[model samples]
Target: MSDVSARDAARDKARDRDGAMSMAGMSSERIESDENVWTRRLVTFLRVMAVISIMKGLYHWAQVTGFIGSEEEAFENQSMAWQTATVYFAVIELVAAVGLWLATPWGAVVWLTTVVSMAVIELMFPGIYGGSLTVVALEAVMLGAYLALAWMAARERPP
Candidate 1:
């Protein structure tokens, strides 16, 4: 090659390397920002869910402890199925709430299980929780939101 052509080629290669390096750095910073954004969203979502779970759990406990109904309609006077359902929810909801508040993987799993279980009971049995369609729909929406946020956060992670 001519001297000028050789020099031009060398310059082009150096420019390409510098451009690649800068692009790499910019992309990494962007990825980190995106990751932080998604992670914060996910954590906030989980904490909100935890609060809801806590409320639900407390409601169930109130029923079991006779704090909600009249003395004549207390937990001891409830049907076997109602008592069983209330007890189950009282325990599981609190457990899941704790997990979600911590934002741990197990918390997500537990919350998912809790949501699915409530949906199932509302759909299949229809008598456990009064079969509230609104409750079921809300649960479905929350579940979808949680899954979407988790997916987005996971995608932002570097390989």
Candidate 2:
């Protein structure tokens, strides 16, 4: 290829990389600028995560203090492993919830951290958790949401 053609090709590649986030897909400039929609979404994700965390914290507190019960009335079930898992999961959820609510860097950190943590845990101990699939999918979506907002906010450089 000609030198001029090679230069054009390189420039085109760079543009393509930038275009992935060029924001050209945004239909309305006002919405894009205000982030009213985005903020609502971010807040929703954060709140859900936060509430889950708070509930989880409370759940763990109950288990650690020997307060959790089995109203199922089936097989006298409940074990140390279950208690430990309850607390562990609760702690992670609590951190994620708080971080998200505050919208601090910690929240973003928690999002990424817990997303990977839960995914790894699910793979590591599939049978241990009854609702791992639901939890993983939820966290994965939240993680994506947080990351997208973070990237947009950073790239937009709003003043």
Strongest candidate by lDDT = 1
Error of 1 at 143 (Å): 0.2
- Computed on alpha carbons, the lDDT of every model, listed in order, comes to 0.91, 0.68
TM-score of 1: 0.77
User: Which candidate leads in TM-score?
Assistant: 1
TM-score of each: 0.77, 0.57
Question: Cα deviation of 116 in candidate 2 (Å)?
Answer: 2.6
Candidate 1 global CA lDDT score: 0.91
- lDDT per residue as tens, model 2, 1-159: 699999999999999977865765553553344645566666676777777777867876665565665564112355555556766766776777778788777876776776787776676777555547787887687678777965665554466
Report the lDDT of model 2 for residue 89. 68
